[model samples]
Each structure stands twice: as structure tokens, then as C-alpha cells.
Target: MVSFTELNQQNDTITELSNVLCHLIDERSVCDLKVTCDLFFSYVDQVKEHLDLEERELYQSMLLHSDQNIRNTANKFLSGSGEIKRVFGQYLKRWSKNKELRINDHDQFVKDTREMFQLVFNRIEDEVEHLYPTVRAVQAAMPK
Candidate 1:
């Protein structure tokens, strides 16, 4: 299992990357910079990777734990994870293609991008407030 510190760090990094992305978008209505597009693609990949690790190293065990509350929490997270993944996929399809972003509607793109980042931020906050405590309690109760 990964330590809570590492998990927290991953969340921080994810948040930082999203913030950078938000800034890049906010500074310019045009999404024509190669660097900006690169970072945007990279941000999506990093977020997906972090989520994969989080699910594997943290949530899976909780799903099968002896406690009902833990199982319920895990189920909720899993459901949320699916929804996030689905929405992100749709967003990518709309804005990006072949490693490039074609933002035909700049204003709408900015709005959607911010909304996506907000969703990511909300998920991280939710994990910190609910998921981590439950996982820590489960680990503490286990025979170390």
C-alpha cells in the first residue's frame, strides 16, 4: 500500500498541474501555443495516471473490507471515478485531437476547462475529507 504522504503529494501535484493549465488558458483566449497544448495534454495524462494509482493502491482494498461503511465509501468513490473518467473523455474528444487542441470556441473552451479543473479539485477535496480518514482508520485497526 502507498503511504498517505505519497497519496497527498500526488493530489498536490495534480492540483498544481491543473492550476498551471488554468493560468495558461486564462492568460490567452487563443489555444495556439505549442507549449500550452503540450502542457494541456500532459495534464490530462497525469491526472488519469494519478487516478489509476489511487484506485489500485487505496480504494480497491476498501471495497472488500469487512466493514460496511468502508465498502460503501469505496463504492461511492468508484462510481464517482467512473463519472469523472467518462466526462474527461468527452472533454478531450471535444477539444483535442491527435495530441492537439482545436478550440473553435475559445470562450466556451475556457469555461469548460475551468469546470473540468473544478471537478478535479472537488474530487481531491472529497478524497482528503472522506476517503483518507477512513483508509487511515482501517490501517490503524489492522495488525501492523
Candidate 2:
């Protein structure tokens, strides 16, 4: 039973974290520069929390409100989550195998990760800007 204000705050926090993580992909050392190690972990944690909440609340709400065609499109976006999970597993495997990746290899890692991040980020932005607005309208229409 989260309030709308709380949900909005969570959305804002998630967007801010995603933007920071995008920048960090270009410069991992930036995490060290401006944030405490604990804060870096917090950012990671928040991103995960945001994703979970989006799947549970926002996406569900959107699906409940959308027509079939739009719901199918949202399904396509979700299929990309499998790709994200595969890439994440690959990253873990690579890390485990090497113990530490070379600095040069980090470029390739960033390239792959950036592609995956963009897919998720774009879907999130689309849902936030378009689909969620429809959901809000649906909420407004309902008896309260």
C-alpha cells in the first residue's frame, strides 16, 4: 500500500541511479571519486530494488490498463530481460575465470554491458513516459 508520492520518489531515485550507472560504465573509477564505497553499493542495491518494484507495481498496473497490442509490445521488452540475465551470468563467469580482467578487456565488457543497459533503460523510459501515464489515467477514472 505505497502512496503515490512514495512511488514517485522511488521512480526518481531509480532514474537518478540509472543515469549515474550509465556514466559509471564509461568510468568505473568515478564511483570511487565522488561516493563512499557504501554509497556505491547502495546505488547498486537501489537499482535492483527499482527493477523489482517496476516489475511488480508499474508493469503490472500498465498491463492491467493496456489494450492487447500494447501488452504484447510490453512482452517483447520483457524478453530482453532474458538477454540481460544471460549477459550478467557471462560477466560473472568471466570474472570467476580470470580472477581479474585486464584493463583493456574492460572496454569490451563495457560495450556489451552498455548495449544491455540501453535495452532496459529505453524500455523503462518508454513505460514511464507513455504506458504509466495511461495507467495514471485509469487510476483517475476509477472510483476512489
| Best-performing candidate as measured by TM-score | 1
Q: What is the lDDT of residue 92 in candidate 1?
A: 91
Error of 1 at 104 (Å): 0.2
Q: Output the TM-score of candidate 2.
A: 0.57
Each model's lDDT: 0.87, 0.55
Off by over 4 Å in 2: 1-8, 18-43, 59-104
- Ten-residue stretch with the least lDDT total in model 1: 23-32
Candidate 1 residue pairs that clash: none
For candidate 2, give the lDDT of residue 38. 41
Candidate 1 lDDT, 1-144, residue by residue in tens? 888898888788888888888878876644778989988888888788878877888887788799999999998988888889999999999998999998888889999999999998999999999999999988888786
Show model 1 residue runs off by greater than 4 Å. none
Q: Give the C-alpha miss distance for residue 141 in model 2, angstroms.
A: 2.6
